[model samples]
Target: MRRNIIPIGDVIAVNQMLERRGSALRVHMHDACGGQSFSLRADDGTSADEASRQAVGEFFSARGHAVEFSAGGGDFWAVRP
Candidate 1:
């Protein structure tokens, strides 16, 4: 039951908005000592699912994550991953 509301500010950041709408994010957080993860993305505009991926990518970059949109066939388009 994850959601897009970070609650940091009334105005959600561009990256947050992008992540929310583009469906391009997932994460595994760790309060322990370490963490690991993976993600999948579609942004070719070839399918409805990829429609917002571009926005998500932009948002991720804005948020300060190193993003590779499609170097990998299933590049973790998800910003969080």
Candidate 2:
């Protein structure tokens, strides 16, 4: 999986486990830029989902983003905005 790490601030917080509901492949962003939700990668397969999730977490950490993932597991990447 490949994802572009956008330099946003602390917005996402919480661990999302996509084992049950699979996973969210993309999301829409409503801001001044104005554009549809960007599709960074495909989260359909099992490993793909895991890779995407880990990438997201690492992306946030690399940018010093203040976010947290679910402690154990879940199906959604919880965020706080």
Candidate 3:
């Protein structure tokens, strides 16, 4: 597994834009080798930020990675468990 830190603000902004367009927000992730990609959809009635966090958590968890959040929720990083 690898550690990848994602900016919270950017994810939230993109999700908000998708919400305004009545489309589901999709978070995509690629494996460390960049050989595979996965997409997770945001759930309805949940804030984009929260949904993003959940999706990221689930993604990392499935691959035996650990997800850690930064102080004040500014960002998150996924790494080997």
Tell me the tens digit of each residue's lDDT in model 3 across 1-81: 566544455445545655675656555444455433334455553334665656556655655556765553324456546
Model 2: per-residue Cα lDDT at residue 24 = 56
Report per-prediction Cα RMSD to one decimal: 9.1, 10.9, 9.5
Q: Whose lDDT is greatest here? A: 3
CA-lDDT, candidates in order: 0.38, 0.38, 0.52
Give the clashing pairs for model 2: 14-68, 14-69, 14-70, 15-69, 15-70, 16-76, 17-74, 17-75, 27-37, 28-37
| TM-score, prediction 1 | 0.33
Candidate 1: list runs displaced more than 4 Å: 1-37, 41-48, 70-73, 77-81
Q: Tens digit of lDDT per residue, candidate 2, span 1-81?
A: 222333333223212332233555432222334321222333453223456657656755655543333333223232333
Residue 6 local lDDT, model 3? 44
Best by TM-score: 3
Worst 10 residues of 2 by lDDT: 10-19
- Candidate 1, residue 50: the lDDT equals 51
